[model samples]
Target: MSKRDLTDKGTISRKYAKKEILKTIIGYLVFYASWMIVTFWLLYFFEEIPHFDWILWILFYAVVIPFIVVLVSVTWYSYRYVKMFSFEVLESDIIIQHGVFNR
Candidate 1:
């Protein structure tokens, strides 16, 4: 089968699939690692405060949960968008198929 034929059958192009998976993993790891580093830095900087442990826990959850949720949502949306919008390497164009009728 042709490359285009494979993509049309809902099979991701191998090259694009590998690239997307790597990008997704790296994106997630970088985001979470940065958050962790910042959290620890803040905790250390504010060590003088009383009940800092409790405060840190509260702040960490308050900030990290929403951040994680938003990041995950955006990531998922990106993957879905990429999957739906087929890419043609030779033509250098993306075919974005939308709506139930189109499918």
Candidate 2:
């Protein structure tokens, strides 16, 4: 048996990039939504919790805003990443390589 080199500089289509980015964003949202629901429930369940009301606002601004910013940044980068990525499927092996440092 001989190994075949199926590697080619395949182009990354726009539709593929959009699909991947949307999938990533949806995954992030699903995880974030569940965690936020639990957090809100805990915050509301506790009665007469001192300073909790103020803490809620502080945590929302400090944590949530930064997360949203980072998520957007990551999605943008991921679009570029897909553009620069490569996949190889050989007769007996498969490979995937991705990076943008040298691009």
Candidate 3:
């Protein structure tokens, strides 16, 4: 469609390109997967320390709780972010709207 048509207030808003969405998803998967791997490694490493059972307890809470909370929030936020995101081209300007809770 023409930029002019997109410029109309509510006439046309386009979502992100497929390549962009795929890239974003892959990036997230890589990041979170690495995080889990490192956390598990740390837990295993700490198990050998003397009297570090306390430390293990602390790590459990520090890693698991925050991981769950952050993961869920990020998932929800990204879903909303992608759903709400759009761009429009005007005659002399471009408008992009993104984000969910923070936008």
- Provide C-alpha RMSD values for all models, in order: 7.3, 6.1, 7.1
lDDT of 2: 0.67
Best by TM-score: 2
Highest lDDT scorer: 2
lDDT of 1 by residue, 1-103 (tens): 2455433324344465457656766776787678767867886798844476776776577656765776677667656755565433333444434412233
Q: lDDT tens string, model 3, 7-92? A: 54432222433444456566666775687678668867888443568757755776556656666665665565566665656777
Off by over 4 Å in 2: 1-9, 48-59, 86-103
Q: Against the correct fold, how does model 2 do in TM-score?
A: 0.52
Query: Which ranges of candidate 1 are over 4 A from the true structure?
Result: 1-12, 48-103
lDDT (0 to 1) per candidate: 0.58, 0.67, 0.58
Residue 88's lDDT within candidate 1 is 34
**Shift of residue 94 alpha carbon in model 1, Å:** 10
- What is the Cα root-mean-square deviation between model 1 and the actual structure? 7.3
> For residues 16-98, could you state the per-residue lDDT of candidate 2 as single tens digits?
66776677777767777787677767877975354866767856885678668867887787677777777556666655566
Q: Check candidate 2 and list the clashing pairs.
A: none
> 2 or 3: which has the higher TM-score?
2
